[model samples]
Target: MAAQRMRDRWKTTLADSPYGVRTIEAIRPVLDQWVDRRHGLLTYRLVQLLSGHGSFGHYLHKVARRETSPSCHECGDADDTAQHTLEVCNRWNAQRHTLVATIGGDFSLPSVVANMLSGEESWEAVVFFCEEVISHKEAAERAREDTVDANPLRCRRRGRRRTQFAARLIP
Candidate 1:
């Protein structure tokens, strides 16, 4: 079937390719095309954490130039990456404790994926942690952005670049 072929192609591509869902790949190294049995779609905050492309200071400061430093704004830890936020960040201790109580053991990407796949309650717990932590971070980021007058030229250039890139893809 076409779906099977696509799944096979995805598995092959993921095996060799360096990019594309590296976070999921890291946890589930031997990637299998699993069925989505869950009802709800992945949330924005959850996707951001999964993709490592959200309001994390490391990404904002280094990649987007939005923040002043890579250190965590809440805890002052170096490199406020998704992994750091999920696993070790003191800021999310209570939430982390709740997650740990639900899932047990050290919180890692693999564990998250495993627990999420195991049952609905586990999935909800992970989603709750992601929603709480990421929403707070996003709120902080918005507050910070509000205080600063972002450069209009920078925004225009970014839009222009996206348009130019899209144009290149078109015939």
Candidate 2:
């Protein structure tokens, strides 16, 4: 059919492109349909988990260079990536267990996508895990930021900047 041809063409084009390689690889195996009526709008946390561009230490410390170390703040793992958080991190074992219970033991990206497409309960389970885990990570990150901001050296640096700006204004 014409629609099938178009989808094939689109997939070919996307496969050839250099951009979005990570996203492409993640969904390439299981992306049969473009859209589904069962799923609702994606949340921030869900996007972060799916896209690998959020509070995870691998993204924050390595990809974004925001954090000092690429270690799991919760469990001290070498890398706190989306995969680790979803499939391996002990910090979220309970939540992961719940997801596994709903979607079965295979938590690979393709399995997850297939399971999500299968039913609402499976989709909600993934969403809940993403929300709870990412929310906790974000809150911990904010608390760390607050602690860092309270450092006397940081306050002195801010005062120094203000003093330099005032000096420039006087001239």
Candidate 3:
């Protein structure tokens, strides 16, 4: 049953295909290493999600395919997926930059997610990244509201405040 589900989910073409075999083989070493590390709750949860053991992969699929929209709690974007939420979304780029800068290297979404799931990066960094993402999302939302409200005071206040706040927090 699990095998069938995996085949369907990944849209496997040839039976026992080389790519499939290699993907599973690659994942095996990571899984073995994770077991040895005895990761704490956060890591354990991340592993569960990444592996489709729990609802993580399912939820991600739903968001990515637009089957569901977990409104960016911060930016209020109707659609939120791992890619959009982390990479392409301009609203959260500032925060993402801060987190990436802390890691100190060229990093992309896939690398970050892989490092996070493989426990290659410190948990502190992961937690900080999550918090920064959320913070920027909220800032984006507030800015949006200010724009729509058309109130001179709110507009003026947020414009000056956000720039200063971002400068201080980011640099």
Candidate 4:
């Protein structure tokens, strides 16, 4: 059937890509579930961050060579990473507290992310946390720009500005 063929193609694509089959299986609900459409953009970004398509300083240093240091700017001890942001950053303590309070109690990481991405109950909270992360990073970038730039940097919220360090992906 045509539907079966399409499914096979999608499966093959997921298997060949970075997330692979197992991860595709785990996060598939994030694709099909419709309860969180209001937070779609942020949810998509979160999914990208979780699935290795989004930016993180450690990943940038290790794989992309976009950043000079893997160490976190906020804490200055561990690598600036998704796992660190999600579970362990002291700088994000208040944001994480909000997330925990929204979700109610400690749950396993996978379950929490899954519910955030796919379930109706936690979408708004996840979006808020993600927005906080992005704003926090942007604020840090503005400070860095201020210290380094002879002319004060103007904060722009337009389309993404590509840098020389950005790697081109054919796909």
Best by lDDT: 2
Minimum summed lDDT over a 10-residue window in model 3 is located at 49-58
Candidate 1: list runs displaced more than 4 Å. 26-33, 148-171
Q: Per-residue alpha-carbon lDDT of model 3 for 78-117, expressed as tens digits?
A: 6454444545556666666775665544344435544555
Model 1 per-residue lDDT tens digits across residues 1-171: 897687677667776767645574744443441354553357888788777889898888778876677899899898999988999889999999999988886666776777777777887888898999999998887666655575432132347878889889957
* Candidate 1 vs candidate 3, TM-score winner: 1
Best TM-score among the predictions, by candidate number? 2
Superposed by TM-score, candidate 1 places the C-alpha of residue 107 at a distance from the truth, in angstroms, of 1.8
Quote each prediction's TM-score: 0.78, 0.79, 0.38, 0.64
Query: Judged by lDDT against the true structure, how good is candidate 4?
Result: 0.61
Comparison by TM-score, 2 against 3, better one: 2
lDDT by candidate, in order shown? 0.76, 0.78, 0.47, 0.61
User: Which pairs clash (backbone N, Cα, C closer than 3 Å) in model 4?
Assistant: none
Candidate 2 — what's its lDDT? Answer: 0.78
Kindly list the per-residue Cα lDDT of model 4 for residues 1-171, writing each as its tens digit. Answer: 886677667656766676444346555544434322554455654664455433456765677664567777788855877667767768888888888877865544456657666555586777777777856665675665456442322332334555432445553
Candidate 4, residue 50: lDDT: 58
